[model samples]
Target: MHIVITGAAGFLGQRLVTRLLERGRLDDQTIRRLTLLDQIEAPVPDADGVEIVAQALDVTVPGALDEVLASGPDVIYHLAAVVSSAAEADLDLGMRVNFDATRALIEGCRQHELAATRLLMASSVAAYGGELPEVLDDMTALQPQNSYGAQKAMCELLINDYSRRGLVDGRVLRLPTIVIRPGRPNAAASSFASSILREPLNGEDAVCPVPTDLEMFVMSPGKVVEALIHGAEVPGERWAPFRAFMLPGITVSVAEMLETLREVAGDAAVARVRHEPDARVTAIVSSWPARFDTAKARRLGFEGDGNFREIIEAFVDERP
Candidate 1:
């Protein structure tokens, strides 16, 4: 089987690549070729019996995906997108990359004329917004307040319709904010979530952009990679009725995350986080529903971190 991962240089894509290499198979088929595509070439592991191809290409440029899809991937993990704040800051860039590029990839799959190909897209909880149920469920309607979420929601519909037309076997995982990402902060409004813990643990002062009381729906990177693999392996019929659903996650307040940090790394680490609110970020982050009735995800075999403590500890242990 050949697998193609777009945005393969990003945090999640890189982890997913490592996990796939470790397993050596997806949906019971041996992965013989792994194609990684992004704006810059991604790093690949040296593994026996697997051919690795990493390239730097813009998906939005005409014929960009055509060149990649010619490799004929059996499965595609679409993880590329302009993040929340960046998307909001530049409408044209967001629409070009998030909307146009995504559409091109899906259409490129259709043009492949393959019998079937699995498409696993990384959607976001940002897809839900405005007045929402205290705990969002599978049945909640999408009313995205941000450009990033709106683009993802739109792509979900496209994937569903394309799947219905027998163009591709697609599934959308509406992910919670992935916490404790290791690295310097990026433009994502949710970057603060990881910054609060990651920076402080490294002995650097970090800024808390939102109120301490603000709540967030979060998942650890380890669990999300597991969810991605599981989502790819599930049979098509099991997800036929609906191609999109939320992944399970824990609801943690800003205060709760800091408390967990204190427990894991002591008061000095917790003390490094400073409360300096940013209204723009707070608006975008707060509009998302923090609590979710993810019985559907749980029933479907997706899992999340048991608590914030595990999330922090996992970060400490696994990060390079």
Candidate 2:
């Protein structure tokens, strides 16, 4: 099987690539070639049997994906995006990269006549906003309140329509905020979710821009990668009628996360977190639903982190 991963240089992308390499197979088919694409050149992994091709390609550019798609990959993990805060900050940039690029990929697949190509995209919970139920579910309508969410929601519908038309086999996983991410924070509005815990554990000061009681549905990096893979392997018949659904995640408040940090790393680490609110960040973060009824996803065999403590422990144990 030939597979392609966009945003292969980013954190989740890198993790997915590593996991794929370790398994060396997908849907019981041996992975003969792996093409990694990113704005920057993606890292080429050491795979004895698999051919690895890393390239710097801008999907937003016209015809940029032609050469890549010409090879006719069996599966494509479209993980590239402008992210939440970054997309919200730059409307044109967000629309171009987030929505437009996705359309380009779908069209590319259609033009290449690769109807069997499985395009698994990484969507965000930001897809929900404004008036919302206390607990969202797969049947909830998308009412995005932010530019980033709007862009993703648009892509979700486009992919669904295209899938229904038999142009492409697509699956959209609406992900919760991924917490305890490693390295320095980026522009994601939820970056603080990881910062408050990650920085403190590293003995560095971190800021919490939202209220202590603010709740968020979150998944760990490991679980997100696992969900992506599982989404890819599931039979296409199982995804009928709808190609998008929320992935399962644990819901926890900021204060509870700190308590979990305290349980794992003591008060000193918790003390490093200082509250200093940012209205923009808070508005975007607060708009997303904190709880979800992911029964559909659960029935689909996708799993989430058992608790915040397990997520914290996993991060601590995996950190160098």
Candidate 3:
């Protein structure tokens, strides 16, 4: 099967591509080609048996996806987005890139009869909004507080609608804040989860945007890819329960993360973190769902999460 990954250069995208290469297809020669399209060109992984192509793709612009769908990939992972913080800052750009661009691609594929391609859109936990609860059901109504969350919520509806109309076979997995991301910081508000560990490893002090008590729904990069893969492979009838599932890791407060840091990297590493909470940051963080009962994900064979300590240790190992 030929596979296409949009935002293939981004954090989760890059990692998922590596996972795909390492774990070859179950069906022989099923995934012999991979096309990665992103605004910034992704480094196509070199493998003996797979053909990989990396291209410059701007999903927000006109005529971008038209040329892409012409190749008719068997599966498409539409993972591109501007992220939460930036989306909140620039409403128009956020709506265009995060919301409109995604819808456009869905419509484009539908019109060209390419919607049969399995589409795995990387939606976010941001889709759930207002005050969070201890547990969120698969059928919970999306009450997004911010524009980014609202946009994600909107896309989920579209994804379901297109699927119902038989225009596409798709699933939207609302991802938790991914931890242990490598390289530079991103526009995602959750980028701080990794930044706190990353900068400290580089011997630089990192700023904490919220109080140490702030809590968040977190997941490892390993788990993020697993969710994506599972969403793609589930049987169609069993997929309705998975149209949207919260893929979250261990829920913990900022204080718990810092404590874990100290246990793994020592008090000095923990000391490198300084706090100066921004009100806007607090409001945004507070509004997000920090914990969830991932019963649906568990029943579907998803795994990868524990204490924040394990997460911090994993982050240290993955990045170093």
After superposition on all C-alphas, the RMSD of every candidate to the true structure, in Å, is: 1.3, 1.1, 2.1
Q: What is the alpha-carbon lDDT for the whole of candidate 1?
A: 0.90
Q: Write the per-residue lDDT of candidate 3 for residues 1-320, one digit (tens) a residue.
A: 78889999987888889988887872244578898999989998788789999998789998798876888877889999887888889999999998899899889879879756788888787788754456767667788888888998888888888887778887788888887778777666666777888778777888888888888888888878987877778754566733667765678888887887777888888789888777876777777887677777777677757677777777767764
The TM-scores of all predictions, comma-separated, are 0.96, 0.97, 0.92
Query: 102-190 in candidate 2: lDDT tens per residue?
Result: 99999999999989999999898988987798888889999988888899999999999999999999999999899889999887778
Model 2 misses residue 207 by how many Å?
1.5
lDDT of the structure predicted as candidate 3: 0.80
Q: Per-residue lDDT for 55 in model 3?
A: 93
Over 4 Å off, model 2:
none
The runs of at least 3 residues in candidate 3 whose Cα sits more than 4 Å from the true structure, single-residue gaps closed, are 26-29, 131-134, 185-187
Per-residue lDDT for 113-157 in model 1, tens only? 643888999999989987798888999999999898999999999
* Model 3 vs. true fold: TM: 0.92
State the weakest 10-residue window (summed lDDT) of model 3.
Answer: 235-244
How big is the positional error of residue 304 in model 2, measured in Å on the Cα after superposition?
0.5
Q: List the pairs of residues colliding in candidate 1.
A: none
Ranking by lDDT: 2, 1, 3
